[model samples]
Target: MKIIAISGGSGSGKTTAAKQLQQFLGNDDCKILSQDNYYHDHSDKFSGDGSVNFDHPDAIDFHLMAQHLKLLSENKAVEVPIYDFVTHTRKKETIPFKPTKFIIVDGILILSQEILRPHFDFAIFIDIAEETRYSRRLKRDVEERGRHPEGVKIQFDSFVKPMHEMFVQPSRVFATHIAYDNNSLANLFEDLKKDFF
Candidate 1:
């Protein structure tokens, strides 16, 4: 496949699946693009504190993302933005991103916009229970992402959780594949090879 999208609500295991698929598909043949990389620029507008409402689709620069995808689809080089969530802004410099065969785009709101729909050959959704997602998010943010547990919990309660029902959950219906609490990357990897290779 030229491009595949791995999408779901935040902390729903989309990252894990994208990584597994990339490794299985091979680094030379696979490229992963996170929609998180396209987060809206708030440096000039909002305070450096990332006080902007990030849960909304308007909070991302989908136009830039589309341009990057068009470049890859045309077999050209593109620079992907590096986004720092802790700082909640993109860096000044972008790094080169070129793919040989497959491109895997992963994030929460990737598939929600129709502007991105025509770019994907296939789309997969990683889904988990609210309790599991919340728990996993709490741990990952606290440990890996350097986020405060209490802050994460508060965001979940006030924004993340409600937005899932408002936006994320409905997008699941459009997915070609739906994975729920299933960590069987090996089986999924092998199955994908049969389907795509």
Candidate 2:
């Protein structure tokens, strides 16, 4: 199996890129695991004013995610956790994930973690301007995540931007390729299809 990581700051197009890759490679052949699903269950509030730091690397259960990735790499099946952003907790059940020809793990912190970094055969960092990222993030949070605009803006200003600078942006150095635009990301996938297939 070919394991790839698509990582970037929130709303920097990492999830979109992963979905595009899955479409390009075919869903039967490509599988995606999102790091968001591994968020540690917390009863405390996750708002901008809350004490919990969701942007931090400690927010996810990396060890479990790493184990799941390893199993997928070895053609083994695993139960991937299901996290609820609304309730800030993990679901009682997990989604069964089977092995596939391509495993695409997308997350902001995937490349930042030393343990997870070595698991990826290829790494992609979606590079976007902070303004664009913030704009996209604001829309996504408000529309998809049911977040208030004011809270989203406060979080972006407080944690998201700073964490991106501290962890996500720095992780770019570890990526095999950097995608600055959607076209480039598509081209990269086309090139990989030729190389892998």
After aligning candidate 2 to the native by TM-score, how far in Å is the CA of 184 from where it should be? 1.0
lDDT (10s digit) by residue, model 2, range 1-197: 99999998888999989999999999999999999999999756665343466889999999999998888878999999998877788999999999999999999999999989879999999999999999999898788877788888888888898999999999999999999998999899988889898
Superposed model 1: Cα runs more than 4 Å off = 43-51, 183-187
- How big is the positional error of residue 196 in model 1, measured in Å on the Cα after superposition? 1.9
How far off is residue 143 in model 2, in Å? Answer: 1.1
Model 2 TM-score (2 dp): 0.96
Candidate 2, run of 10 with poorest lDDT: 43-52
